[model samples]
Target: MSKTHFPLPVRQLAVFLSLLFSGYLLSCTASEAQSDTPPLNPNGDSELALLMRAMFDDAQAMKQQIKEGKTPRPSLDYEKILTAEATEPDKAASDTYKVHALSYLQTIKALQQADAAQAASLYENMVNSCMGCHKALCPGPTMRIKKLY
Candidate 1:
């Protein structure tokens, strides 16, 4: 015996398409979310200090990688620190804080792209961004940001 298949109803097809579209959107959002680094704590002294130290450490490591002609390992800890900072409670100026972290990440990406001069330029901007944030949120790190150069 032969079997016949019927076409799906238009409403069902629309629903399926809607679900597929939603899934696609969500996947894109998830990937973007994964790429973002969290903000550092704007208030915790120890946490801010640690993150500031990590930022310098990561910068040094990136420099060392360039000097040794090796690919730098990504700093996963920095991302976590930034995430925590970005999500901290009572963050009235969180948007500005996030901009600083993002600037540093952008500079790092430029460094990874192999343009030494452009990367160097971005490095100063990155330091500036950090300084700008630290000046208000964690003043103690102002000197540390200067040392990163």
Candidate 2:
């Protein structure tokens, strides 16, 4: 039998290199999996948070349709915005939040009925109501919601 032995330093270097390469690969994988979707709340997402994400996705599609001079379709039953559970119950249960939620629904209804020409204006109003509610209850989302415009 013939045996070939690597020097101790050479073996240690190989181990270190293997670990370094593994770390780099893992980091790349993690970065690739990252998405534009917002991170979940520390306490996990509430029903309202998930609905808002669906709303945002729908709004993006609607905005594209509007840009192409097509009518924006409302796919979500948005009345849930008023009753959906919130990550923070204290904030969502407030009278102010209720008012904002109602106003948002009104704007959404108006936008849904808008003609092609009026869709843009009504859409803007709808987005404004969203921002307004965010501003009143949680300002963190106002910036993200602005991208809807």
Candidate 3:
């Protein structure tokens, strides 16, 4: 028999990355709120609708876990927002979306790093970023996203 094992941190990073990707897929598939015809934005990228639903699903799950007094492990792959082909290429390249997305990402990072007492407020700010972006680009999902809080 041959046996090989990765170092602890490497293994942990692998598991975390796996969870981040799987969370996206699971979130998409598990969401019952998704409509058959996704609401496309002005740029006409319907693919982003599914991604948004997946994110919403993930956010809902995280909020639920926190409400249950559990520290939900961070599962976002910030790189996906940068690289995902489903998004509008031009919008991805836009400084406006990038700034809003970065704020959301930073809030998530803060929540991930925060102690329990601070997580709730950080989570609210994270959701606020979602609202801010939606208000500017895709207002249709604003109410749905707001419910994540």
Candidate 4:
């Protein structure tokens, strides 16, 4: 058998370099694993986000009540939508957004005033209101809001 040989000092140096390179690679991987995730907002979600989440819940309940032919007196003060501060304050300040918010509120009010016989359509209108506003302003929730139908 033939053996490849290196001088003792050269072999030790190669071994030392291999160990050092392995340690560097391991440290790099560890650092990558510890990379920071998104930081939570210190002040928490905007009032508008919170309000919308509540509205979504109320709508879900109302939808169920509607299916059962029961009147849904959703207690959520949807008017708060106008005054609530949004996550992106600039978007809330726009004229287009104001109109959308008013449109959404009107749909909710209509849904509330309608009889059970008219509720399915009114509820559909309400969902459409959300869809329209979200589609124009924030498309992120559009898919989720579609499930309301």
- Of 2 and 3, the candidate ranking higher by lDDT: 2
Q: What is the C-alpha RMSD of each candidate to the true structure, in Å?
A: 16.4, 7.3, 21.6, 7.1
TM-score of each: 0.49, 0.72, 0.63, 0.73
Poorest lDDT segment (10 consecutive residues) of candidate 1: 84-93
Candidate 1: regions farther than 4 A off: 1-49, 63-77, 85-88, 91-93
- Candidate 3 collision pairs: none
Model 3 TM-score? 0.63
Query: Judged by lDDT relative to the true structure, which candidate is superior, 1 or 4?
Result: 4
For this target, which candidate reaches the highest lDDT against the unseen true structure? 2
lDDT assessment of candidate 3: 0.75
lDDT of 1 at 65: 63
Candidate 2 residue 92 C-alpha distance from true site, Å: 1.2
Single out the weakest 10-residue window by summed lDDT for candidate 2.
33-42
Global CA lDDT of candidate 2, please? 0.89
Clashes of each: 7, 0, 0, 0
Please list the residue runs of candidate 4 whose C-alpha ends up more than 4 Å from where it truly belongs after superposition. 1-43
Best by TM-score: 4
